[model samples]
Target: MTGYALRKGLTFCRVDGRFVFLDLPRDRYFCLSPIADQAFLDVIAGESPAWVAAALRDGLLRETADDTRPVACIPPAPPRGSLHDNNQIVSRTSVLGALTRRAASRVWLRARPLKAVLDRVQERKSSRAGVELSVAQISRLAASYRRAGMLVSAHDQCLATSLAVAWQLASLGATPHLILGVKLHPFQAHCWVQLGDVVVNDQLDAVRLFTPILVV
Candidate 1:
């Protein structure tokens, strides 16, 4: 694995009292609470991971919000050859368009003000039963759609689509279960989202494509 500092276009910040960084041109993101962030910085600064891990896992903030994540520095661009011919034949199943549509759909679906569904689901489980859809799931689906979207000339790989999905779902009072991964290849590292055992809306078979850093 490449050293954290060696990672290109890497930017860090303190968010919601947590230390976090967003890797650009690639789609990966990472976070740490105040204490945890210190540890990671320490590790990047030459601190030992063994000791840092011990301290981090002992007692610290367990969860971080999506909106609180570090910002993306480098935005995405259109695929190569997008402006080549005068054909102007647009594809409907583009990756970017699909992600946008899926993310928007989740937001619209949640705004129905359907208290009956919430009431019934909570009655069956707990107050949090069906309050919201999983952010991880949405991210995955958006990714899949984006892949299709890209193929159909609808859109290209834009990291913000995943961020939008995460933000929208969180705003709807939905449960957030996100597992993020970055594919650090020769060209760039791309990010992907995952839920329990499923890769949501994966454009390609994520299992066959990405190498996971953490499964969440």
Candidate 2:
């Protein structure tokens, strides 16, 4: 019955590490591998309106592969001109100080499973000390996501990996953001996790490589 329902609904399924088409909600049937089915089930079971939005965004990105498109390169800022003389005073101060602070708190409050995952990932990936993510402790995944995106855009790297990481963060109950920027050369936007001025996964090179721009 479950299989039949999934097939009729035109839903997606994972089977044997492959994606399968299921014509769900129409009494039709399509089959997928056990792994795909399980993953699909997990996603479904964990479904929430919030997650739905994220999934849609991710789906759209995947469908068109826009996230993979190269970001335009931005030229270096010319020395501050007379126009900036006055504005520079304020810009130099706290540009997004409030937003950053709010975001940091939000990530710490909402993030789940981030610390554990980070620990596991670190254990497996690194042997160096000082390579730990600064905000791994806080539950502020959304804030982290935003920060990560900004870092990636500034660095110019792959966005897909960042998206994957963001998705993982959202699943853990963190609010993430997608950041876009062009500096020096063309690159993809990305996401990050944060905790009170500390960056989670800062030591992970994945931040430099993946461009996760949006939290959803």
Q: Which portions of model 1 miss their true places by more than 4 Å?
A: 1-155, 176-180, 184-187, 212-216
Per-residue lDDT of model 1, residues 20-110, tens digit only? 4544334346555556566665564544454444543542212232322223232222122111112233344444555565556445435
Q: What ranges in model 2 sit over 4 Å off?
A: 1-157, 185-198, 201-216
List TM-score per model, in order.
0.32, 0.21
Candidate 2, run of 10 with poorest lDDT:
78-87
Best by lDDT: 1
Candidate 2 residue-wise lDDT at 47: 24
Question: Whole-model Cα lDDT per candidate?
Answer: 0.39, 0.33
Count backbone clashes in candidate 1.
16
